[model samples]
Target chain A: EAGVVQSPRYKIIEKKQPVAFWCNPISGHNTLYWYLQNLGQGPELLIRYENEEAVDDSQLPKDRFSAERLKGVDSTLKIQPAELGDSAVYLCASSLGLSSDYQETQYFGPGTRLLVL
Target chain B: AQSVTQLDSQVPVFEEAPVELRCNYSSSVSVYLFWYVQYPNQGLQLLLKYLSGSTLVESINGFEAEFNKSQTSFHLRKPSVHISDTAEYFCAVSARGGDDKIIFGKGTRLHILP
Candidate 1:
C-alpha cells in the first residue's frame, strides 16, 4: 500500500565531493527509473532499469554519474566529483514492466534534494 | 528522438475559472502522451495519459486533455480551478515502442488565485 520511498530527503555537498541517493519502489514493480530535475525545469530521464538490466542510460553522464538496481527493487544513484550544476532533485520511479499485458504507469518517489556548492 | 513543448511558462487564474495549458510534441513514430503534476517539494504524479483508444482523456480532479493529431498537441484544461490545483504541470511523450523513455517539457506552473 505504501508508495515509492527514497532516502536522505536532502543532501548538501561541496564541488568535487561524491553524493548518492537511494530509492525503494512500489511492490511488484519491475521497472525502475532515475531522473534529474533542475530548478524551473521538468524531470529528465537519466537511466532506466528493467529488472536488474539497465536498458537505457544514454542520458546519464558516465564520467560522473552512475546508477544500479541490484535486486530490481531498490536503486541507488551516485554522482562523483559533483559540480555546482549537478545540484538538483533526483527522483526515482517504478512501474510494471512492459509486456503484452502490462501498461507502464510510473509512480515516483519523494526524491532526494541535492545541493552542490 | 521525441520532444515536448509547453507553450506557457506560467498560467495565473482565479478560483472557479476555466483554464487551459497547452502542450505540443514532435515525434517520428507513434507515441503515448502524459500529463504530470508536481507540488512544491513533491514528486511528479500522473494527471492523465493518452495511450490509444480515445483521443480525449480526463483526470479524476476535473482536468481533461485532448490529443489532436492534426495539431500535434495535447492541451490540458479544467472547467473549474481550485487553489489546491496550483502546481507545476509537465507534459511528456514516450515512444509506443522501443525503450519507452519519456521526453518531458519545461513545465507550466499553474497559480490559482483566491
Candidate 2:
C-alpha cells in the first residue's frame, strides 16, 4: 500500500503572505495529523482529526493557522499572513482510528518544506 | 503529559561499527514507544515500536531497542551499521489513554563515516 502523500514538496513565500499545504493519507486510515517541525527540532503536533472531526487542536495557532479534513481522507493546512518564524517543515501522518484492542502505527508523508522570508 | 529526550544530536560512526542512540521519556502512565527514521528528503518510517511485549523490539534492518521501564529509557542499538543507516532518528511516546497524542524528542542525526 502507498504511504501518506503530501503536495507541493517545497514552498517559498514572504512574510505576511498566505500558504497552504495538502495531504492525502493512506487508504482506510481514519486518523489524520498535522505537525510542524522547525530546524534541529522534532515535529510538534498542530492538530489531529478522527474522520472528519478534529479531536485535538490545542497546539494549533488559531490566529494564523487553520486546518480541515472535509472528506476524512484528504486534509489541508493553511497559514495566513505567514511570519518569518513560520518557516519550517509541515508534516502529515495518518493511522487507524481509536480502538481499545488495536493501536495501529502512524505513517508519515515526505512533508512540505516552507520558507518564509 | 509526556515528553521525550534524545541525548545525542548527532552520532558519527564508521561503517560496519556498532552504534547506539539514547532516548529517555517521562510519563505518569503506561505509554507506547516508537523509533522513526527519516532519510534525506523522505518521510518518517517506523523502525520499531514497543507497546506491551518482552521489552525488546527489532527492526528488519538489524536495529533493536530495549524498553527499560525502570530507567525510562528506550535506546536504539545496532551491532553494525551501513551507509544506508545514515539518517535522522526520532524517539516518540504516547500515553495509553486519552487522544493518543505523541510527543517527540529532538531527532538524532546518524552519520556513517567511511
Candidate 3:
C-alpha cells in the first residue's frame, strides 16, 4: 500500500512571492488534512477535508493562505505573497475515517520544506 | 478548545538508558491523546494513542505511554533506548466528539548518545 505523497520535497522562494504545495493521500482514505510545522514546533492543522467538504479551516490565514481539496483525493495549499515567517515544513496527512472513534490514526507525507527569503 | 504542552524541548540520554518525555494538556471536555515521532527530514509517525479504555498504551517499538486523567498528562517512556530512537516526539490531543482536529504541542527532541 502506498503512503501519502507530496511534491516538491523542498521549495525556496522570496518574500512576497507565491508558493503552493501539493498532496496526494493514500488510496481510499476519506479524510485529508494540511498542517504547518515551524522549527522546534509540532505540526499545526491549517485545514481539514472530509471528502470535498472542508470541515474545519479556522486556523488558516485568510489573507495569504488558501487551500482546496477538489474531488477530495488530492489537496493544494497555497500561500501568496509569502513572508519570511512562513518558512517551514508543510505536511499533509490522511486517515481512513473522519471520526476519532473510528480509524483515528493519521499517515503523513514527506512534507514540502519551504524556505522563504 | 484543547492545547498540548511538552515540558522538555530536548532530552539527551546514553544508549540503553531509560527516558521519559513529559506532556500535559488542558481541555474542558473529554479528549483523545496521541504521540507522534518524526526522524530527521521525515514526516510524523504514530507512536501510540489513548482513546477510550486502557489508560496505559504501548507501541510496538518498546515505547509506552500512560494517560493520567487527574493530572491530564500523557508522558512517553522507553525502558531502554537505542541510538535509533533519536527523533522528535510530539504530543497531541483532540476533542472526543465533534471534529477530530488535533492540537499538537511543541515537539521534544530526543537524542540518544553513544
**Highest-lDDT candidate:** 2
Off by over 4 Å in 2: A98-103
Candidate 3 per-residue lDDT over residues A21-115, each given as its tens digit: 99999999989989999987889899888887888888999999999988979999999999999999999999986473323999999999999
Give the per-residue Cα lDDT of candidate 1 at A39.
86
Q: How high is the lDDT of residue A63 in model 3?
A: 98
Candidate 1's TM-score reads 0.96
Candidate 1: stretches off by over 4 Å:
A100-103
- Better model by DockQ: candidate 1 vs candidate 2: 2
Q: Report the error of model 2 at residue B21, Å.
A: 0.4
What is the C-alpha lDDT profile of model 1 across B19-106, one tens digit per residue?
Answer: 9999999989888999999988778899999999999999999999999998999999999999999999999998886565798899
What pairs collide in candidate 2? Answer: none
Please say which candidate is ahead in lDDT: 1 or 2: 2
lDDT tens digits by residue: candidate 2, A1-117: 889999999999999999999999999989898999999999999998889989889999999999999988899999998999999999999988766311457799999999999
Task: Tell me how far the alpha carbon of residue A78 in candidate 1 is from the true structure, in angstroms, after superposition.
Answer: 0.9
Can you give the lDDT of residue B56 in candidate 2? 97
Each model's iRMS: 3.0, 2.7, 2.5
Candidate closest to the true structure, highest DockQ: 3
* Number of colliding residue pairs in each model: 0, 0, 0
Docking class of 2: medium
**Ten-residue stretch with the least lDDT total in model 1 chain A:** A96-105
Q: Which has the better lDDT: candidate 1, or candidate 3?
A: 3
